[model samples]
Every structure is written in structure tokens, then in C-alpha cells.
Target chain A: MKRRISLFGALREADARGYIEVDVPAHSTIAELREAVQHYAREHAPAISPGLIQRSAFASGDEILHNHRSVPEQGELAILPPVSGG
Target chain B: MTEIYTAVVDIAHGPLRPAEALEFVADPRFGGIATFIGRVRQHNLGRVVTGISYDLFDALALRTFQHIGERARQEVGGPMKLYIAHAKGDLRIGDFAVVVAAATPHRDEAFRACRLAIEAVKHEAPIWKQEHYIDGHSAWSEGCSLCEEHRAEEQRAAGLAATQAGDAHGHEH
Candidate 1:
């Protein structure tokens, strides 16, 4: 399954469209999604480090998802990097 | 008709108005009002910062701001009004990036609420800032260290859990 994930902060620099598409198995958990995203980054976004992806949290709408939680079947989710806003 | 105001939170795409925040928090019943403004400075870590771009997850950011306001009000425990606004998009040096204001019956509560709101917004809000330098390069500013701390804590807990499971398995064998 293909999921479109919104990118923010430094992750935005990775793709000009400000988002990325990752291929994951259906009903993949957040941990699996993160691995797919990391794989995509490694191949396409060399500037973004695996550590950064590892530290980032995934969000569906306004809620942050735990690693154990499954990704929603529909809708684009966001990848939140370590926040710096004051 | 008189207006009842408790909290005003927004992810502003344009410049943030501190005056508007002051107006929102203004009330005859409140004796003190505290305001905090965060601006983009010219230099950071010995590098000259020309500008900054702020990216935000609008829905989550606003939700977090509301949570911060409610928490501040409860923590301070008084009739209070709070205002929080954070900039979204490009900003030059000296531009306001965030504004937080709190009004309370007493000075201490007002100050405390204001401080609490700003701190929460800095650490909790789903917002990111990329600092553009004079050398035509830009990098995301490292804002909250809490994320790293939380990650470390999670790793530690997982390690402990794995070790405990290993011990149990060894005993069973």
C-alpha cells in the first residue's frame, strides 16, 4: 500500500512538494511506516539522517500516533520533526 | 453587549500583533497582564541569521495552544484571559515569531500563566523553524530537547523490558 505523508521542518527540504510517498504493507503499524519512510529517505533524501527519522513522531490529523498503533487506511498523515517553534 | 473572553489561539500566517493580544486580554476585572514576545534575532551560535521560516501543522498547533491555555488557567487558578499566536511562514530578523499574553487578578498569576503558555508553546506545539544564514544556507533550529530526552527514556524502558523477558525465559529453561 502507498501512503502519502506530509513533511515538515527539515524534512520539507527533502521533497519539493513538502510530502513523500512510502510503500508499506496494508495495515502497517507506525513502526513499520517509519521504517518505510527511513528507507525512502535513505534512497532519495540523503540530507535527512536516519536518526532524525527515528526521532520523528507521526500524526494523523491532530493526534500523534504511537509506534504500536496502526496507520489509518485513508488520509494523509504528517511527520513531525523535533519542534523548534517559540 | 459585553464580551466574555477566556482564550484566543491562532496560527498566524502574517505578522503577529501584540496589540491585539493586549486587547484580547484587557478587562477591568483583571489587575495585571503579562505578555511575552519572541522575535527572530540577528545571530545564533556565532552565525548571522538573515531570516527564518516557520512551518506548522496548523490543526495540531492550534490544538496544542488551546491545551496550553486551559492548563495555564487551571494551574494559575483565577479569572484569566490568555492569548497565544505563532507565526507561520518566512520571517526576517526582529520579526515577531510568537506572542503570549495572560491577564489575571494578580501580577504573580498573570506572570506565571504567561510564562507557562510560552513554554508550552515552545515545547509542545507542532511547529518548526528553519534559520536562514548570511552564507546563503539555512538549517532547522534545534528547539526542544525534550524529544531527545523522551526518545532516550523510551529506549531505556525497552532495554529494561527486553532484559526482564530474557531473565524470565532463562528461568523457564
Candidate 2:
């Protein structure tokens, strides 16, 4: 039994699947509900001060701030591409 | 007979009221409604508090909430209503932090169940908080020392307010 998701938090497009499965609630939003499923690139993500995080700032500011804000908290369900660390 | 059909996620900028939680649970049999409200404070753990930033680490917040609502439906063994709302963004002093309401026929059930609901939320929910001090510093209160910056700032602010309050009373007295 699949529940019809009212609002979703997953990426618009998954690797080969494209955006589909993730569904959140209608009123329940994270950080002003600004989402860009496709443009989830590491370099594009907001930069954080490394230690003292703005906490809600990332979740509340204008989506455009994603690029402009000095720091950003990685949103939940935000797709982070594979990273390699040695 | 009512249904558990709603849940929300938002920034708590002030005190969250549970009774007002009714708009979310619009079922008639719910003669008994139990609500809980959480507030933001000037001091948390003795930290000289300025402000805080809150965020949800997991979309699981709603998922868990829905699960709770469903479980309440089952436990109540009747048509029931439930709602949970939380605030986000920059919540200032004495703002609603969160509100949860559950409707039952008996007040006892409503109160007991609502308490359990909130307890589950606090322990199981994945909410986070970060503190901002009057100084050029901030920290994650989840696991950090209380900086004097926030307390000193709070005392100073309170003193200023108290002095004003005292002056007003003095004029009347």
C-alpha cells in the first residue's frame, strides 16, 4: 500500500529514477520550504562557518540565499552526491 | 467522530498553544483536548542567551508525527483527532516553540496521552538548537558549556527592564 505523498522533500530527480518517491506533509516545511532538487551540487550548496552554524537561517532564508549566504546547513533529504575522501 | 488528518512543521517564534491546537483537530467527539506549549527563554543552561536557530535534521519529524497520530488513533480505539505544530526560523523571547493536541472523550485520556505524545517527541524527535550570544559568539546548546556572555547580557537586559518597571511603580507608589 503506497501512501500518496502530499508534499515531498526528496530530490526532484534521483540518479536514474528521477524525482518521485519522497513525499512530506503539506504544511510541514523545512527552511521556508525552498527546494532545488536538480541543482544540488556541492559547490552550489551554501557554505557554513564550519563550527557555529546559523541553524535556522539555512532553513528560513530565501532560496536565492542558497548561493549568496555565507553559510548553509545541508537541508534534510537534500541529495548530496558521492564524495571521496582519502 | 473526527480524524487525525493534520500535522505541521514551522519555526517556533513564540509560545505554542495546545488548546488553540483545535483548528487542526476539528472533530466534534473530541470534548477533551489536551495541548502543550513550549517557549523560548532568555537563559538556557545558564548561557547568556541572545537568540537561537533551530532546524530539523530529519524529514522524519513529520513521518514520526504521522506515525504518532496513527498510533493514537489505534490506542484510542475510536475516531480521534490529533495535531502537532512546531515553529522554525528566528524565534525570539517567549515565543511558541511547539504545540501538540490530542482529543479524547475523557480529559484523563487526553492529558495522559498528550503527555506521552510530547515525551515521545522530545526524546524521539530530531530537533536541534543553536545559541547566539550577545558577543560575537554562538554555540550548539545540545552539548556545550554555558558561556557567561549570554547570562551577563541577560542580567544586564533584565536589570534595565527592571529599573524601568521600578520607576513606573515608584511614580505610582
Candidate 3:
């Protein structure tokens, strides 16, 4: 299945792309998805720091997901860094 | 005599209005209403900041606002109304960046809910701020860490100066 990973903040800076489509096995966990995203960033966007990827949070819809959590195959996977809104 | 819990969450491109936020939580039965408006300051840390640009993940941000409202209601243990509006895109100094309001039958809960809502919005919402400095540099700010760092540095410098002055007085004695 192809998962559309949406980047935000520093993650977007790392990806150098708004989003990227990656193929993963069914029922892929967020940990696996994050690794895939990192790999994509490493390959595509060299300017993105490893520190940024390490700090990023993965979310499905509005809920921030733990690495162990199962990511829904549907919908965009948001890359959320430390939020600074007032 | 109003809804048990009324929530209004918006991620807008234009300026957020405090009046609209206040109106959302207005109810005849509520005895107290508390509202907080966050404006873009002309300076941050030691840097002269001209403006800021807010970027938000709208769908997720709204979801976070709703969750915050629910959490506030549960914690307050009362009927309440919550209104939150956040601005996106470019904002000049003194522009309203965000507005949070809470209305309840009592002052305590109203204050608690309002505080919680704004804090949660700052920590939880998927919004990023890029501060434009007068030095012609712009960078993303994380929880205003840059400002915090500057403050810390100033405090450290002041402490060192005070210690040095005390040492000079001791020598004179």
C-alpha cells in the first residue's frame, strides 16, 4: 500500500517536499513509517538534518501517534515537530 | 440555559478577532467569561522582531482545539463554552495572532479553562512561527526558546556583575 506522508515544520525542511508517497506493507506501524520517511529524506533531501527527523512526531489525522502505534493506511501521516503556537 | 459545551475552533488566514471570540462564548446563564488575545510583539528576546508568519496544519490543528475544549470541560467539571481562533500567514507587529475564550457559570472555572485552552493550544497545536527579525534574518521559533535563551543570558550576566561588585566592596572593606 502507498502511504502519503505529509511533512510540516522542520520535517518539511528536511523532506524538501510537501509530501512523499511511499510503499509499505499492510498494517505498517508508525515506527516503520518514520524510518521509511527518514530514508526518503536521506535519499531525496540531504539538507534535512538527522536531528530534525529524530525530533519529529508522527500523527494520523489530528492525533499524535506513538512509534508503537499502528498507523492507519488511510489519510495523510503528519510530521509534527515541537509546536510553538500561542 | 445554554448548551452544555459549545466549542468553536478555527484556523484562519486573516486576523483573528477578539470580539468574535467573545461572542462565541457569550451566554445568558454564564456569570464569568475570560478571554486571552495573543499579539505579535515588536521584539523577541534581544532581537528586534518586525513580524511573524504562522503556518498551521488546519485539519489537525482544529482537532487539537476540540480535544483541548473537551479536556478543559472534563477538568473544570462544569458547563462551558470554548472559542479559539488562530491566525495563519503573515502577521505584523501588534496583529492578533490568537484568541482564546472560555465562559462558565463561575469565575474560577472560567479562568482555569481559559488558561488551559491557550496553553494547550500553544503546546499541542500543529502551528509553526517564523519570526522576521530586523537584522534581515528569519527563523522558526520553538516555544519562544530564542527569547527565553536571551533572558537566561541576561540573568546570568546580571548575576555575574552583582557578584563582581560584591567582591569589589569586600576588597574595599
Candidate 4:
């Protein structure tokens, strides 16, 4: 399936750095998704707060996936890198 | 008294205004508004500050911040309103970095609460400040600023770095 992966600020180079349009099979677990994010992050740029690749995996802990307000996919989730305040 | 809460962090094409923040909790009962807005400065230690690299350890950091607010509220008054936001990522010179606002009935309590909140924030929160100095030097803030040994070590490192660069330049010449 196709899903958008966004990395703001310094990580915006993914478009040219060969990190975009990465494929993920359906029913990928949260851990698998997080690994995909880290893979893309490393490919695009140096990893910052790699731990957040795990912490931000599901967006929030309230509900398995839906409770997350940041990156919400019906049953899917995102593992975003550590981002700064606006 | 009404209880109000507004807490989050963001980056912007603009800056943060303390007065605008206070409006979030403004009400008839709020007779006082005290705030702190931290602006990016031009200097730090020895090197000039060019910008900052902000990285927040949110789970523990925000949890601890909420706890401090709860504690201060107990000491000051119940149902007091607060709005605190920390800027993340790169903040250029003159950009806003930190903001804190506290509201209460009497001015005395409001001022006291504001003072305590800012002080508590610096020491308690896990917010780390990494400075990118203007002289091609960038590093995290060293703890224990009052230590003479630490200062001496810093001096030595700067001296060595300068000497190494100077020698390389002389060799090329």
C-alpha cells in the first residue's frame, strides 16, 4: 500500500537522498513500521534521538492506534523521528 | 475560579508573544497576569551564540513539567491558570525560545507564581540546551558552571583547538 512519509526540517532531503516511495506490505506490525522509519531516516540523514523512532511509533499510548492525533492510519501507524516544537 | 490549560510546543515563521499567550487564560476573575518570554541571545560563555539546537525528552520532560505545575499550584492557589510552551528546533537570533504565563486573583500571588515557575522550569525540566556558537564551535551546555577545574579544562580545550588550527594554517602558508 502507498503511505506518505514526512520528515521535516533537516530531514527534508529524503526526496533526493533515495528515502522516499519505500514499500511496506499490508499488516506490517508497529515494530516493523518503526524499523522502516529508521531505515528511511538513516538513508536520508543522520539519525537524531533514534529512541524516538520507537517512542513515537504509535503516536500515543492511549489506544493501540486510533488515539494518536499526530499520524493516524485506520489500523496503520507511523514512527516519526524526534521533532522540535514549532 | 475557572481552571484552564494550554500546553504544547511548536515552530513558526514568526515569534512568540507573551501577551498573546495570556489571552488564552484571560477571564474576569483573573486580575493578574505575569509572564516570562526567553529570547535568543547573541552570546554565551565565550563564543557568540548563532542559534540553538532544541531536543525535548518529552515523555519524562512533559510529565515532570506537569508535576511541577501541580506542586506550585498547591503552594499558590487552586484552579490557577497556566500556559507554558518551549520552542523546538532551530531558533535564530531574536526568535522566541521559551514562554511562561501564570494568572491569579491578586497581583502578589501571580508574580510569585510566575517567578517560581520559571526558576523551577530551568532546574527541574529535562530540556537540554545545545548551543551552536558562531566561531564554528557547537556543544551542549556543561553542567556545574561554578567549578574552577571545569573552567580550566574548557580553557585548555579552546587553547589546544586554536593552536591546532593555527598550525595547520601556517603549514599551508
Q: Whose TM-score is greatest here?
A: 1
Best by lDDT: 1
On the 0 to 100 scale, the lDDT of residue B139 in model 2 is 60
Residues B58-110, candidate 4, lDDT per residue (tens digit)?
Answer: 55446545766776688776547776667666678878777888888877777
| Alpha carbon deviation, residue B13, candidate 3 (Å) | 5.4
Model 4 DockQ class: incorrect
Question: Which pairs clash (backbone N, Cα, C closer than 3 Å) in model 3?
Answer: none
Off by over 4 Å in 3: A15-17, B1-13, B143-173
Candidate 2 TM-score over all chains jointly: 0.50
Best by DockQ: 1
Candidates, ranked, lDDT: 1, 3, 4, 2
Which stretches of model 2 miss by more than 4 angstroms? A1-86, B9-20, B143-173
The lDDT for every candidate, in the order shown, is 0.79, 0.46, 0.73, 0.55
Model 4 residue B9 distance off true place after TM-score fit, in angstroms: 1.7
Task: Give the lowest summed-lDDT range of ten residues in model 4 chain B.
Answer: B142-151
In model 3, how many backbone clashes occur?
Answer: 0
Q: What DockQ was computed for model 4?
A: 0.04
Best-first order by TM-score: 1, 3, 4, 2
TM-score: the better of candidates 2 and 4? 4
Between candidates 2 and 3, name the one with more favorable lDDT: 3
Cα lDDT tens digits, model 1, A1-86, are: 88899998988977999999988988899989988998899899999988888778898766778788899889759888878877
